[model samples]
Target: MQAQIENTAGKRLWIKLSAVAVVVALAVGGYMSMSNTHAAPDVSFTNLKGEQVSLKSMRGKVVMVNFWATSCTTCVAEMPQMVQTYNAYKDKGLDYVAVAMSYDQPNYVVNFVQTRSLPFQVTLDTQSKLADAFGDVRLTPTTFVIDKQGNIIKRYVGEPKFAELHALLDKALAT
Candidate 1:
């Protein structure tokens, strides 16, 4: 009956693995739904070009506000993908603003922006007020996708899946 015992053991292992897969799927779904549906707080910042931009004025467009620090390794690693995502969506009414965390030095932010030749607007939150308004963001590469209705729809920490981001932007811009 050795074959019978081996078959039962394999079935038990398969059942355990299926259970774990279900649990992991549920956890990921929960995390995706838990981003608080808050109205994006009113904020403004001058871009690297020194022109002031207010969130209130961007109400009719899909906005992606990304908080990053120059020294955050993940943030640095994700910059090129972020730039590509913005470029792909900007013409479709996506308004992207990359904000530097206050603790990041101004000269460093400037140099990074210049060296990278980032295509979207890049602002510096020198006072940290913007971070406070955006839920006291203390993490690097925090991203929020705000729909045209001004509701914060998606919040991503670390790096986002660019393809998923494109799909979200596509859905947002269609309305």
Candidate 2:
């Protein structure tokens, strides 16, 4: 009876350890999938004013290249925070540009911009070239924070954590 009880207890411990291992594996995998860091691809899109703005041209400044769509409520919802983030950091060598996804209609983008009185550069990815350059951004509200050296320091798929973003910006600005 004693031996049987010990074996049962060992089996329970093994099962618990296996469950914990699986949870740890999944946590690491999820984090690895989300953290995509790379060099900011060189590309250009037509700004609202019809001038071409290139990511390569903004190499010396911290740039936030955001891919968004008018149809995405989350994208629209985050614009105010984005604007505030830009306004707060622009003077410290931060450059922000919002790129309307290729699937977004130009009229809707224009209307959104006008209604919001967006202060930063708003551009259109009409040809989808810019999207392709930025890892084929098919998701609205995807944002990339590029350092002054043109490396993408962070990529947020949805609304970013404003506090953490501000911290990253602080570090990026100091560089």
Per-model CA lDDT versus the true structure: 0.93, 0.91
- Candidate 2 structure lDDT: 0.91
Which model scores highest in lDDT? 1
**Clash count list over all predictions:** 0, 0
Off by over 4 Å in 2: 1-37
For the record, the alpha-carbon RMSD of candidate 1 to the native fold, in angstroms, is 8.0
lDDT of 1 by residue, 1-175 (tens): 9999999999999999999999999999898668546799998889999899899999999999999999999999999999888888889999999999999999999999999999989999989989999999999899999999899999999899988988999998999
Give a tens-digit lDDT track for model 2, residues 1-175: 9999999999999999999999999999999877756788877777999887788999889999899999999999999999999999999999999999888999999999999999899998888888888888888889999999899989899999999999999999998
lDDT of candidate 2 at residue 105, scale 0 to 100: 96
Candidate 1: which stretches are off by over 4 Å? 1-36
Worst 10 residues of 2 by lDDT: 36-45
- In model 1, residue pairs whose N, Cα or C atoms come closer than 3 Å (at least 3 residues apart or on different chains), thus clashing, are none
